[model samples]
Every structure is written in structure tokens, then in C-alpha cells.
Target: MDEQVITGTTAAEIAASVRALHERGALRRGDALPPVRELAAQLQVNRNTAVAAYRLLAQAGVVVARGRAGTVIAGVEAVAQEGYAADSVLRDVGTGNPDPGRIPDLSSALARATGRPVLYGEPVIDPALEARALAWVRDDLPDPELRITVTNGAVDAVERLLAQALLRDDAVALEDPCFLASIHTVRHGGYRAVPVPVDAEGMTVDGLRAALDAGVRAIICTPRAQNPTGATLSPARAAALRALLADHPYVLVIEDDHFSMLSQRPYETLIGPGHRRFALVRSVSKFLGPDMCLAIAATDPETADRLAFRLSPGTTWVSHILQRLVLAQLTDGTVLREVADAGRHYASQNAAFAARLTERGLPAEAGDGLNLWVALPVEARIVAERLMRRGWLARTGDEFLLGAHPAPSHHLRLTVHDLTAEEAARLVDDLVEAAGRSAPRS
Candidate 1:
């Protein structure tokens, strides 16, 4: 822009211009704004006016002055609703939750699944349902000898897996910035979480090696659709992890393939052959409707037997009714087909959003799940704070970090799949505006 244009601008105009620069990527989060005096003089606005405008943005979380660092663009969450702040109602872009509409309606399926309850003690885990589950498990597990154990949900399976294999206070290697449920499970189980770093290729083998060397007795990892980061484990990384685990056959390996069927990538099995202690857990929560709350875990017989002690059918079944409903749906082809379609839709939507982000000068990446992971040019926390004022809520990279050292990158984990296309587009624009206001004037 011409210097003469700024020279005649009002404080509000300067602010608007600043936002436009951020939107266009001319300015970005964490960049320092020009000094108030310089900006005021440049815009031909009174110093007081510039100061007032800057203060207003700060209060609204658009920007923050960091001691000697001057003022920076607050992170995008700055646009989040701040308790009825006049007209502030930001969109939710955090927590990669599925769109409610995408969930399969079990009404038609459940109607057909009803029948006389299978007799009590009638084959724990419901043989009929287990049969369907076995197919799903086999579809993901590379080894034929892998045994399956059905449980209430992924969490239920995790609890059982730990109970059978790990004593209290045992060290479990888990991805840093793990799923919230996994974090709580490990802590509540009295096990220490040795944080493993996750990257675009999913869990890092070097980090896993470090955790194992730290004396972790077990490791629970996701080969696909990793939570928070929305990263899938790459083939090479998965192979490396499997090779590393081969050296320590005593360590229990639990791989949570939560997005099993819904995932778009070719499934990669991380558990190597002849590994004595290992389990592959797959959850239908994301694809099968979380309400189903059922998960299938295939483990070695030793772990299955231990889980068997607590996994009784009829009285303690993962609800034969629910199992039957899911089974009937899976077999119906319509439900399974719908699930596959939904996965494709989510992947496409996230990809489109990432494209929009790229247009705004932010290089974003999409994975097989319900969201996009964006690396901001500046601090993610600052960007989130800025977006909060604009009524947008988001997740920062810091929250997902697992290691003792902070994650060095500033990134946003966004779940944008379920939202309408128009809503997503508008959100991208608002995020750009927020980024601009917080974005430092170079």
C-alpha cells in the first residue's frame, strides 16, 4: 500500500487495514505491530486513538503485548464467545468431532435387530456379534492368529487391556497430545504416560524408542486417524515401530485403530508377526456412532483370557442389543456403505477447508479424519486468543504436546467436516481477519 494512503487513515481505518493485511497473509500472527507512535503517525491518527484501538483489541483477545516483545496477534481462539459479549458468537473449529447429521440412524436397523435375548452365559461377547466383529478385526489386523475380544468401547477395552497386562503405576508409552480419553485412562489407571511425539506420519519411532528406553512396559498407539493431530501413521514409520518393538517382545503393544473402516488411507498394521505380547483395538465410535459405545480388541490369548474373567455375556455383554443393531447394520450393506460414504465426505470437506487456508497464505494439510492440522506462521496460542474475540474456538499445538519440552511449532487442529460449506468459508474469512488484527504490522 502507498504511504500516502496510510497517512490520511483514521485509527479505525488503520485497524481495518491491519486486519486486511492479516487476511491476505501480508501480516500474520505473532508478528509485532509497529509501535503505536509510528502507526499513529503513519495513519495520521492521534497517538491516543491508536493506543485505545490497540487496547480494545487486546481486551477482546485480538492481540497481546508480551513484555519486551511488543504486541502480537492473539491466536485464533481469540474469537471465541466471551460470555454474551454484545454480539460475539464465534464458530467452533476445535475438537475434530463428527457432524451430527453424518451419524447413521439406527432406527431402521434396530427395529430389525430385536428378538428374544440370547440365553444368559450364552457365549460371552455375543457370538453372533463377535462373528461380525471378527470380520472387522480381520480387515485391519495383518496376522491371522490375532485373537479378538469385544468390549463396551475403546476406553473399556483399554481398561481391560491394562488390567490384564499392567500392574498399577506401570509405565505406558502414549502419544503426547493424546486423545483426552486416553490421557484420563492412563492417569486414572495409575500408570505413568511416557509421552511419544506425533508428527505428520503419526507417532515418531525415535520418540517411541526413547519412551521404551525410559522403561515403559506397554505402548498404546494409533496407526490411523490419530486424535488431536489428525495424523495417520505412515507405512515406513509403522514398519520402523514394529521393528523396534520386535526387540522387546515382553512389552504389551496396544494399537488403537479407532477410525478403522472410516479411514481413507490403506490400513497399515504396526504389530509385527510373532510378537508375543500385542493387541489391536478398533473402535466404531467415530464411524459407527459413538452412542453405540462398542469396541473390538484383538489380543494374544493371555490378554484375552484375563479380559474374559471380566467380560461376561448377557449380564456384562457390550449390550447384545447394541451389538446386534451394529451387526445387522454392518451386514445390511446400507449402513456400512453409508459409513464409508461419510468417511469420504469428511475427508473431502477437510481437504476443501485446507485449500481455503492455503489461499490465505497458510499452508494447511488434511488427513483421513474429520479435521485439518494447520501450522501458523506465529504462536498458536496467540492466534487462538485472537480468534476467540471473533467467536471462534480452536485448539493450540501446546495442549496436544506430550513431551516434557514444549512442542516447537505453532499449529491449529481444526475439525471442520460437519459444518456447512458456507459456514466453513465464512469461518476462514473471520479467522483471517482475526489473524490480521493480531498479526504484527511488518
Candidate 2:
């Protein structure tokens, strides 16, 4: 076999070769590629071409740039959330999806959205939706110069928001156990992910200050319902973070309020009165359903203008139909009631499960989100395997880790909102048994 794994001249050709290598098992995750200069000399191509090739690979999440460590195959690839294994006989509690039964019908809203055809050069954001979104966003954000722009969803909004503000190789502060989409977006855009640990109150003050000191140009935070952990920013924590960020006003701070109206916790923000370069994104997916595919991004006027350039006429404006549909659901009393009910349902179900886990002597914390973050008394992977044997599939916390070669985590993020009372009780028992079985005897 040839030791020369990468072989191509052009950037596209080189990227394709790397992808081929990855697919064939020739390139495993975390395997470092040859240095840019070395690979260029080997391929007889210019150094710039090799650099471009690596850049493309990084952008596709096939590779990652580790600063002084050079590039390596991505430990966590950017793809859709992993769901149940097809043909598996286990009940899947790993999928982070809202209950289909609870998602409100949008037939009436869709019917009303059929009025007009949006043409090129028309306003990218619908006027009525903008007005409503502006009022809604303003009620929460303390910054008065905020502007609203709608995107496909929370992920798209964050991607564009980061792109508008930072360049490739720039450091972006991310929660340690972050949302998968945010993780993927950062990795795919070829940006460095600075781990900011999150406590129960939200992002830790020391973590934020350290990231800032490390020269992070941007910070992506989840104000509420932080995925995987279900942590929300407490008012005191938010105030402290806001105070710290006031000194570094130019660092682009993005707060993804993906849970938004669905969260039981009150909305707290880190963007202070005069803080510049910030974005507050709220997606309709949690309440309206993932298929709704629309999110409102409220950002500073300058960031909004840069985002607008990317969303210009022939570029990537979110569909007007989806925007109108979200607006209709937001304005409709019956739909709003259904959404509110769904939110309560999620909270109640998670709380009940957390209580059961605690009663069983396993500490579990249920925060404001669709999933329950349960700490295991043993390794999460072993407990997950035990659950699989008992016909319950679960998501281990290791999958959400940011740093390289992190210590094994003992938490599992379970989506138990759709489970019945009997089912929930059965799951709790199984989880308790599984944890006990996986625990090493003292």
C-alpha cells in the first residue's frame, strides 16, 4: 500500500481524495495529515493549493485545524443527529425530536400563506413577520439598535451570524457540552472551538473570562435549554456575564434562544445596553415543530447588514412561506395555546422522571428543556450499553464533548417527553438497574 494517501493537484481534487480516504477507512478520526508544506511537496503542487485543499476539507467537517497541532480527521463529524438503528429491536430514547403527536397542525396557517409570490429584490424578511419579531425580540434584548433577519433555523442563523462577524481560524467560545448543530457549524466553518464550561446557572464566569483572554473573537451561547445538559442562564449569571462582556464590546456574542417560548424559564440576556456585535436567535422549531424550519435572528445593525449581504436576492433568504407559517402560528390563539401546553408537557414529564431518578438514589437534574440530563453512577457508555440490552437506546454525553481526548463523562441526555406513565416508570427502573450493573463494586 502507498504511504502517500493524499494525491491531487487542485483543491477540489485534493479534498475529494481526502474524503475518499476517510470513506475507505484509510483515514480514521483524529489521524493527522501531513503538514501543508510537506503534502504540497509530495503532490508537487503549490503550498497555497495544499492550504486551500486543507481549508476545504475543514469546511466540510472532514478535517479539523488544531492550531499548532496541525490538521487531523474530525473526531466528531458534522451530520444529522443520530437516531435509532434501523432494524434494531430497542425503544429509542436517544433521538432529540419533539413528539409528533404534540406538534400543532399548520394546515390553516399554510392555507393562509398561499396569498402571494415573493420575487427577487423584494424585502428578504416579510414586513408583518419582521414587525412582530422586532417587538418580540426587543421585549427581551436590552440593546435598542437591534435588527431582525429570518433564517432557515437556529443552525442557519448561527452559521450566517458567525460568518458575518469572524474569519476562518478565528476562535469562537462554545459551551463545553454544546449543542451538536452549534458544534458542527463551528467545525464546518473552519473555526477554532474554545471550550467554556457550563454550570447549572449557565456559562461559568471563569470560563467566559478565560476564553476572552485566549483571544476568542466570538462567543456562541445558549441562554436557555442548553442541549445535552438542559442548563439555562440564571439572572445573576446572565448579569455577571454581561458585565464581563461589556469591556470586550467588539467580540461577537451570539445567544441562541432555541427553546424560546417553549422554555419555562424567563428569558435572560448577556447583551448589555451598549454592547456591540451581538445576535439573539430564536427558532420556531421547539414549539412549532422542526419542519417549520424558520428562526428569527435579532442582531446589531452592522452584523445584520453583513448577514443581509449573504441573504441578498440570489443568495439564501429563508422561504417566505415558512416565515408566514411561523408568524401565523405565533399570532394564532389556538396554536399558541397548543404550543404552551406542549411546553408544560415537556417540563412536567422531565420533572417527573427526574424525581423518580432521585427517589431511586440516582441524582438527576431536569432543567428547562425537552430532555432530562441524568448523571450516572458509572461510565455513560457502559450504562447506555446496559440500557440497549434492556431494549432502551440512549445518548451518551461523550458525543457532545468539545475538547480532544476528554475524560469519560457519566451523564446521559434522555428525551422522555413522549413516554407514557407506565413507560416512564419502567425506564426509570431500567436506568437504575443498568447504572447499578455498570457500577464497579467497592
Candidate that scores best on lDDT: 2
Writing each residue's lDDT as its tens digit, candidate 1 over 1-442 gives 3333322256566666666666777666787787788778866678998887676556445566665777776553322211112433666677566766877888898797897866776765667767777777775665666667878899899988887887655689998767767777776665668899888898888888998899998898888888877788888988898898888988998888888888898777667887878888887788777777888888877878878888875456667677777777778778788888898998898888888777776667887677677777778887889888777788776766655674465777777886776788777876666555333211
TM-score of 2: 0.85
TM-score of candidate 1 relative to the true fold: 0.76
lDDT of 2 by residue, 61-127 (tens): 7888777998888865554464455676789897888888889997898887876799998899989
> In candidate 1, how many Å is residue 110 off?
1.2
Query: How well does candidate 1 match the true structure, expressed as C-alpha RMSD?
Result: 18.3
Which residue pairs show collisions in model 2? Answer: none
Single out the weakest 10-residue window by summed lDDT for candidate 2: 76-85
Question: How many pairs collide in each candidate, listed in order?
Answer: 31, 0
Candidate 2 contains a number of clashing pairs equal to 0
Stretches > 4 Å off in candidate 1: 1-90, 313-315, 407-409, 437-442
